[model samples]
Target: MQCSYFDAGLCRSCTLLDTPYAEQLTSKQARVEELLDAHSPEWLSPIASPEQGFRNKAKMVVGGTAAAPTLGILDGRGEGVDIRGCALHLAPIHDALPVLARFITLTGLQPYDVPSRRGDLKYVLVTANAEGELLVRFVVRSEDVVSRLRRHLAALQETLPNAVVVTANLLPEHKAVTEGEREIVLTSRDRLTMTLAGMRLELRPQSFFQTNTPVADQLYTQARTWVDELGPASVWDLYCGVGGFALACAAPGRAVLGVETSVDAVLSARATARREGLDDVRFEAGDATEAALQAQPGEHPDVVIVNPPRRGIGETLARWLDASGVQHVVYSSCNPVTLVRDLEWMPGFRMRRARALDMFPHTTHLEVVTLLERVDSPATDRPRVRMP
Candidate 1:
């Protein structure tokens, strides 16, 4: 992966240029193993994935002159460095960069200046599915540039017919989040839909989806296989963004409840279920920990699937699951440190299996899926084996 963009000092976002891809993967796998062995040995796995350009979404920082806009990492002093041809993005996105940049210039929308905070457009985030359909979201400082964005949308549609959905996110605040409280639809619809393993997933501008679509499909398929193999009577998907896990486990005569904090995500999940005619699966908007605690005793699920953020399952949620009658838990974590920490809190649960999915390549990050099963009963004294 010879990246001239980085050589020319145009982008420094990927700091792993000096390291080989194989070495990076090995180092990450070793780090994960060490963390799990020292903390939660049972969750350790030796498997790893090959490193490559696995990014599915691109969040470029817009800066420099609009006529010659730069898209890439911010400098040490906070200036956008051009990286339109980054190595981490998929080939399609990389191939489409020049045209996209031309469209941006043709539209005459000014790129937001972080220091001055004057421009209307902050960033242009583009998400592409496995099937090559693109969803474009323009993060703007305010709705003042609606006309500029509209003109840009028309040109983008003409220039890049593959762009399926386009929308404008109004972020008037000076916060770090690219999105704002309000979103204005610049296209025919306010949402973009993608299909994964025969299931449809609706994506809002702010909704969370795995950036790497190929590995994400593998992750979802693995989770589905595990759920089906367990054959649980009921399932509870906590932190179920857009019902990824819930929809994966949908089957006849099996009831699955998905709980998420995002109301829009829950609504999208429900819409997908309705479209698929999957009456057994439903989604609700609420804090996952609170939802789990409030679940009726009789309605307690036999299996629980939690894909929490980097913070991992907090102490409160861990305690709730410790007391709950749930028999199985499939934990998908992006942070190994937090995952091991949470596993230490629940000693009653024994690790059954684990696998590392390389979702973000060219970086140190790794996604781990762990299956933990509750011990039916406590047994008397036994020798404890030290972790390697």
Candidate 2:
């Protein structure tokens, strides 16, 4: 993939684009192997996929002028470089850039200047699934430009009828995060629905779904297979964002409980479960680690699925899991370093299967899922360990 924009110094966000995609995958695989060797060698495996145009979400910085809005990286001095047609985005996003830019210009929306911090529109986030339906959210500093935004919304809907959801996020304060306190729906509906792995997920403006929807489908399918093979009587999904794993494992007789911290995500999960008519699936909003600790022995889970943040599970959670009488565990992590670190403390648990899902292409980030099972006896066939 030869990127002329990158070569001309227009944007260096994807610094590895100069290198061959195969070489990049090899390097990342080696890094994962080294981390596993030094920590949990049994979990190491060679799992690499394509690394081109796989990102399903685009978060572009608005800069330059409203007439010619630039979409790309922000420089160290807080300047935006125009690379909207870069090779990393999906084909639809690349094709829609010029049209969106022209619409922004015609609507007279002011592009936010980071250094000066004196504009209404801060950023524009666009998300699309495999089906090509788009969900757009505009992060604005204030809601003073309602009339202008309303006009632009009409124009955008006419131009792109496939846009399922359009929202405006108002952030009156100066913050780096893309979210805000108030979200106003510019469209008739408040949610955008997408299908993944035979399940429908409802996405709001600020909801945190996986960026790579296709690979996310594969990841969830693999997790479901692992759970089914284990024949778990009951399962607990910790840090379950929107209950992806919980809903996948839900069956007629099996019970699955999903625990998450975000109230919106819990509501979405419960709604999905109800829509699918899965009576055995349930979701709750609370501290995942605390819920796990407070679970009574009689309600001991047969399997526990943990999909933690980049930092991985904390020491307290790991200790509690080790003492818990769970027979099987599934761990999904975006950071392999933390995953390996946590696996060292789990006793009598051996790795059964491991897979890598290419979630963020053209970047160093990857998602990994590992299944672990407990050994019944003290003396058993332990797997061989190799150091990197």
Candidate 3:
């Protein structure tokens, strides 16, 4: 995808901007093959995203003055690069950005100046659902401007009619993270609801969701299809952010449980299951790897589904899965390098099939989903003859 920000020598996030879309897919598939061919040589055609305007979230840095605020990355010299018209964001984000800038201008909210260590507004995060509805959050250094921004909420809402939830996050310290420990809700409703893969899910400001909606849908659909074919009696989803996989895999007789470290994400997942009356699915807030080791007899899962972060599921979990009696494992990884590192421990299982999803376009980042099955023991099946 062509980007004006990249053209003007501003944002260099998209490393493969000049590469053709087809070649980009080929390169990603080849990288995965190089890493995983030993375990799983079978592959499927990589799922591709549209060349432009597929991003459903925008995290724009609040820079410059409120009167003339900039919505993009900041330079080392503390100057802002105006990327409000970036082609990666969806139409709603592109449309709401000018309104958001105007809101900042009208509210007299000062953009946080990193050099001076002053100002209130530091970042503006906006997320869009399938219906183009938006959830906007303003990350500020303190609560000094919360009342002012809340006072002019109507004007911001008037500018962007699709905005359903608006929140104010306070970051009291000079830290690298965008969010803080305390979250002050500015909207009457606490959740932003959306539909994906034929399931309705409610999301909070802090909860994690895929940035690309179409590819995320494809990812969930592919996982659900595989699980449905397996028809496992029980499934455990590890690192289940908001229970995306568990919700899709839950069936009438199947028992599904999702474990996440974030309480907010666990709460969101439970709320979704409760809202849908999914009695067979549940979620817990805790470290998944430790919890799985102590899982009760009744709660033990036959098939395990893991959607781990960039680091992959560390050695402990890999060794546990390798020795566990579980018959099948569904692994979804964002980092192929770490994935291969963890896969080496699972010598007992063989990769049945693998597919790549182009979750982030104009970049090298890709999501891979693989299904692994434990090979039957020789004692369990009688062989006609042994090669000698």
The models' CA-based lDDT, in order, is: 0.77, 0.77, 0.86
Pairs of residues at least 3 apart in sequence or in different chains that clash in candidate 2? none
- What is the overall TM-score of model 3 with all chains considered together? 0.94
The 10-residue segment of model 3 with minimum total lDDT is 379-388
Candidate that scores best on TM-score? 3
> Which digits, one per residue and each the tens of the lDDT, describe model 3 over residues 1-388?
6787798789888989989999999999898888888885479778999888888889999999989999999997987777999888899889999999989999998898888888889899999887889999999987877999889999888888889889999897987887887788887887888678888898988889888888889999999999999988888899999889999999998888898998888888999999999998989888878986775432346789999999999899997877766778999999989989898888888999999999988798999999998884423232221111
Tens-digit lDDT track for model 2 on 206-291?
66678776688888888899899888778889999888989988877787899998877888788888888988888988998898
Query: In terms of TM-score, how similar is model 2 to the real structure?
Result: 0.90
| Greater-TM-score candidate between 1 and 2 | 1
Query: Per-residue lDDT for 121 in model 3?
Result: 93
Instruction: Give per-model TM-scores.
Output: 0.90, 0.90, 0.94
- Ranked candidates, highest lDDT first: 3, 1, 2
Report the Cα lDDT for residue 266, model 3.
89
> What digit string (tens of lDDT, one per residue) describes model 1 on residues 1-388?
5678667776655567667867776787777777766434354343444344567788888777779987766787767788877767776677666777777788777888777777777888888766777777878877778888786677788878877878888887777886787778788866668677567798776778888777788788888998999998788899999999999998888888898998878888888889889988988889988986666553457789999999998998887776666678999999988888897778778778777776766667889888889985533232221111
Sorted on TM-score, highest at the top, how do the candidates line up? 3, 1, 2
